[model samples]
Target chain A: MARMLSGRLPDPPAAVRRGPPWAGAFPSTLHDQRVASLLGIALGITFGTCFLTGLVSHFMQHPPNWLSWPSRPVWLYRVTQGLHVTTGLASVPLLLVKLWTVYPRLWERPPVRSVTHALERLTLVPLIAGSIFQLATGIANIAQWYRFHFFFTVTHYWVA
Target chain B: MSGDGDGDTGARADADAPAPAGAGLSVGGFALRVVLVAAGLAALGYGVDGLLTMPRATRPSNAAAWLIGGIVVHDVLLVPATMLAGFTLSRLVRAPYRAVVQGALIVSGAVALMSLPLWRGYGGSVDNPSVNPLPYGRNLAIVLGAVWAGAALLMIGRAVRARRTGPG
Candidate 1:
């Protein structure tokens, strides 16, 4: 049975055996886990601030029947929106460096086929894509470019 | 992968320990996962609802163009420019003052970006006297000047401390 199986099995392709094209391109200095963790926490805080402030602005614009927005502050909207824009802008640099830090892992070959391995890869899709989407929509909305057919407030709020 | 310290060893041991029969997962982990999933679903629902109820006259193509343009302008142009500035600062600034300089640059960049619309008079409206009434260009300049001045003071303070220490 061992001899019969050996004869039927085909050799693995050269590329599959060799691994990814960027397998050897991971930078030695770019693997600082401490920097990555620090930046990740910072980014998370900035994103949370942006999201919360965005919610406030949304509610102010479209208050529900049970909710009443105050007009006494006068500059309330301006401050919150300014904060949202500033935090969103600050996120640009933080996001870039965070991506740079984990970039090497993008090329890492899975050592074993497992559910955990697949889940790890799947989670990255939302992390990267959602970040880009949020930032892009945010900048455009602030610029008041309404290039899309949908309402900017609705899309931005949901995305946030 | 590199086992460097006792903290890592302790963490590994915790991971290897068997889970409790009634509570297999950590509370923090479970809560975080639940919140993340709910947020995702909420966002998806809102997006779908927005799309379905959008005005017929609204043009989606413009929105798509702006979104794509933003990504290109940021990733292709702004990122590289910031990277170049960072590289220049790292090469020119001494180790003792590098962090201060980098901090100043980041603060200035954020302020400048936030001030762009104001500088361009995008938010100025005669209908509302309270909206963007201040002179943004002058305000931005003052803010940036203060940031640099503060950074200079920090550098001086560091130098004084180093001098007092008489060389490590």
Candidate 2:
């Protein structure tokens, strides 16, 4: 009998056999990850600070009138406010950079055996949607000098 | 017919990966980064000058002081205290990370609630005349102090717990 060579091969569905354009195309270096990490760190810190300040500002019943040093009439409320607004403005660039750095990974599906992949897919919605809403509403709030309709205010309040 | 032992298609698959013939990092990123640093420095400078030039009567007076106090209490005191307490509780209960973060956020939300009333322009400014600036400032302070006390207690409680449990 003539030797017909046999290397085991399982038939793949035609759709599976045809790879997407991005298949096997990954950055050869960690440059993207590094960019992402740096951007994430900046964003994380700025957002944390702004959020903390906003939280404190929410509860001020009587504005600070320095009791011991009762002479300084500096516009302290205005100053903290400026900080909050500025920090918020700064988040725009950081968010963009972060999204860009992680863009490539979104396409890569999980290998056959892991729940980690499922969880990532699930959380992606809230993380992205919440982030966008927070940033958008924040910018809008600043534009209006922190003024907004009660509905938007309430929604932003909860989302943030 | 040349029967090559190895079927080596040597054309690199990654040739397209590099920046296109003229493409490079986005100019916008560089421009935006410069603007951010400039704005931050400018704000810091203005804040410092305002703080320094503050009036020094028989009783020292500075609006900048109020802002600074607010900033410090919020960032340094309220946040750290809440975080420490939440962290302690998490360790004690073996709570999930999300729960801890949510707790901290909720505390922050309380502060934001207090700040809202003060934001409504009830307080008059030198530029913008107001009928009730005094009440405005007082109102803000009362809310802030109440929240501060609560946060401080939580912080102290966390410390006591930490001492008893030997620090997580």
Task: Return the TM-score for each candidate structure.
Answer: 0.60, 0.37
Residue-wise C-alpha lDDT for candidate 1, range B1-168, written one tens digit per residue: 011021122222222223311133466754554455455445544543554466443234554454456556655776558667867887899989988998898788766765566666664357676766788788888999999999999999999998999897
State how far residue A5 of model 2 sits from its true place (Å). Answer: 42
Per-structure clash totals for the candidates: 4, 40
Q: Chain A TM-score of each model, in the order shown? A: 0.76, 0.66
RMSD after Cα superposition, model 1:
9.8
Worst 10 residues of 2 chain B by lDDT: B1-10
Model 2 scores a C-alpha lDDT of 0.43
- After superposition, the stretches of candidate 2 with alpha carbons farther than 4 Å from their true spots are A1-21, A24-31, A61-76, A111-113, A145-150, B1-168
- Kindly list the per-residue Cα lDDT of model 2 for residues A1-160, writing each as its tens digit: 0011112234445544433235544332322766666766677667666665554454343346652323345676566667766776677656544554555454433211123223324434333444554555565444343333333333443334
**Fnat for candidate 1 (0 to 1):** 0.12
* Alpha-carbon shift of residue B133 in model 1 (angstroms): 2.6
- Maximum-lDDT candidate: 1
True contacts kept of each: 0.12, 0.00
